[model samples]
Target: MDQVKTYRTNVRIGNWNEDLRLEEDAKNEYLEKKQRGELAAQKVEVLKQNMLRPVDLTASSDGRLHFGDVVMLVNMGGENRARSTVSINADINSLNKTPSPAIQAPCGISAGQCVDACTRTAFIITSIDGSPEGSTLHFEQSFALRTTSGFAMGLYLSSDLQSFQKCSKKSRLQEVNLDDKCSFLTWWKILHFDPQERLEYEGQPVPANEDVVIIHCKTNHALAALGDQVLWTTYGKEYEVTAHTFLDSHKAEKDTNHWMLCTAENRLELLNQSQSTADNQEPTEANPGI
Candidate 1:
């Protein structure tokens, strides 16, 4: 009988399997955190059942009022006597120095209800350190009657009130057109023509107009137009005819004096007009016939 040979192989775990295990652990941890957050929010809602009330007693150590002492109150704004008794609670301690109170109570208190028969409003002591003064007392008064205008509290009465003003309507701004013209030509330098019922050159004879043809040096690409036209070549060159329109010869004369020519290519060259004499110059109203 022939002897049988058997081989045992050890298999190694791949990185893909390890990555999948890590992703699963991360997803489980995220879910656990979400559940915990929801539970904490529910606990906060349950705690809101208890409301705060002020005390009228003064602090024994400092003259400051304690959390539950009751006292008389008065409104200096209007000599209004309050009908209801005031109580000191935690709500009174939170008030700032400003007489105007921004805190909204579950039951609203009125200015008339803030004072007593002797013009003294009775308030309970709720907070020992009610204010920075330490001696300040916070009080609340309640009554069955409700005022049409809500009660004003704290410094809100003494301070200046702000009024709203209507805003003015916005005016539209005029748009300026820097590149608007009729006809033009580029022969190393650009020359422009005027716009009329029919297309014509500004200086050169109409028969020689040649339809303002533009020819690219390398590609020999050609573009032609009868009047004011703009052309874009494949080589990224743009040619515009009469890029600027002038009202009269006087305006055109001023532009020519300050005219600057620039190439669309990397290099910019200035066209030389010094060689042209007065006899060869074109005629214009300002130049009296060039």
Candidate 2:
């Protein structure tokens, strides 16, 4: 009789365990559904915010790349500066070259369209001025007399341009690894390109052709480049710029000249972009003050 009682007790415990397992599984499923619903709601909110308020990419700031601000490109090779306006387009390749003067005209091109009329080379914005007619983006270089289109004729986003407000100021900046996912508002030091020796990190090979890394800082700081001098101001304190170079196996070199402080707003912009990608959602506009 004792043996039979022991058997019955074992059976009861087994049944209890099974019921508990089912309860736990149901709880997990409910939690997952709730999370998914919250995510969907967040995405809707983002879309709504963007639809209600569009961003202007030409507002003026003290040498920082702000939304709606027009930038001029100076092709140092030819000593010619061309004018172009900044738009809300995320694709930076949209800007095209115009006629020989390469000045900003009222005409606009769609994203990915090439401006076939001017010479292309890496240029810097020499002067930034704005007006209602349209902001003037001036470059520093003049084109050759040839009518041929230059391979470099496009509005290339400066790799040095950072979101400034996204990264943490206390973190040490270093070269980004292939598998590394860069967090928002973190500073990273990049090595400029060099043709001689290839760059390696942690015994793994890194490509030398691309910009070292994207860094985020605060927007309240000032960023300026004069000749070789790159300057950044934080809390009203200014810092001098320095040059760093790196090389990779592909016979390409990467170079970096200076640092800039990215603002909190910029950091949010980057975070939104990153979150959109990770979650397969789209970015919506937010209030500038937000």
Model 2 agreement with the true structure over 186-235: per-residue lDDT tens digits: 22222222323324332222221122222223111211112222122111
As for model 1, its CA RMSD to the true structure in angstroms is: 39.1
lDDT of 1 by residue, 1-290 (tens): 98776643554456978998899998988778566533444323322212222222222343222333222322112112111221112132222223432222222122222221111123222221223332322211111111112121211100011113311111111111111111111111123322241223333321211122212222222211111222222112222211122234433222211111111110111012223444577878888862
| TM-score per candidate, chains pooled | 0.15, 0.19
Evaluated at residue 46, the lDDT of candidate 1 is 23
Q: Candidate 2 at 52: error in angstroms? A: 15
